[model samples]
Target: MDALGFSENLRVLRKNKGFTQKDLSDKIGVALSTVAMWETGSRRPGYKTAQRVADTLDVSIDKLLQDEALSGGEYLSENELYSRITPKTRNANHDLLEIREVLRTRPEMKMLFSVSKGATKSDIERAVAIIEALKKDRG
Candidate 1:
């Protein structure tokens, strides 16, 4: 949505990776002018080309198109956001899926899930106590 931001982001990422426009072009198999146009906001690349660019830069496509106006707090690239949103598990067991669904709907539960990373039995017991205290307070 923000073409200027995208252009600036591309330029910054390219430079950070020590890639000249020509070098990026060679890596992505695009003409040098195409990379120049993308950086100048004269043109936008297609989705496939954008993916290639992201791969080359080791960034997410969403990062390339990040809009500051729509973001809150620390800026997370698309990939980062996706990773945070998705539950990491070896298998999609029914219980895990159900837990994920509940977390999706319950902000407090989600917060506890994030805060209780590598949770010990005691940590879970403490969290349950805190949640029960809050519930009693509400009652």
Candidate 2:
């Protein structure tokens, strides 16, 4: 198993689920320090323990253990995506929330055509501005 990948994935998943280390430990009946160690890749859990953690996180064991650089493609979790698009400034999350709303309303609309895989922050912001402009015109 890719310990580093697992740790990063676990951190992302835990945050997305709005669980602090203490909360996750409580859910999985583990110590808070255990969760911290897992997130740091300092320790590995047994198979049964890993399965329990996976189940608690509502993710498969494979997802928890797989390296991100699979043959299919690189896996970018939601947190990774956010970090790529915006570096967690105060307004970045608000911008992302608005962009997510646009995406929800227009799922078929592709933002960046040429570069579909790893879009930069400016690319997303530019696309969103265009979309919002068009929306304003229509309204």
lDDT by residue (tens digit), candidate 1, 3-43:
77778889988998999999999999999999999989899
Supply every candidate's count of residue pairs whose N, Cα or C atoms clash at under 3 angstroms.
Answer: 0, 0
| Candidate maximizing lDDT | 1
Best by TM-score: 1
Task: State the local distance difference test value for candidate 2.
Answer: 0.78
TM-score (C-alpha, index-matched) for candidate 1: 0.51
What are the C-alpha RMSDs, in order, of all predicted structures? 14.5, 15.4
Worst 10 residues of 2 by lDDT: 108-117
In the range 1-139, model 2's lDDT, one tens digit per residue, is 6788888878888887789999999998989999999989998788899888889889977677767723345777867645544346538768878877877777564444435557788878887799899999999
Q: Provide the TM-score for each candidate, comma-separated.
A: 0.51, 0.50
- Per-candidate Cα lDDT values, in order, are 0.82, 0.78
Error of 1 at 137 (Å): 60
Which pairs of residues collide in model 2? Answer: none
Instruction: Write down the TM-score for model 2.
Output: 0.50
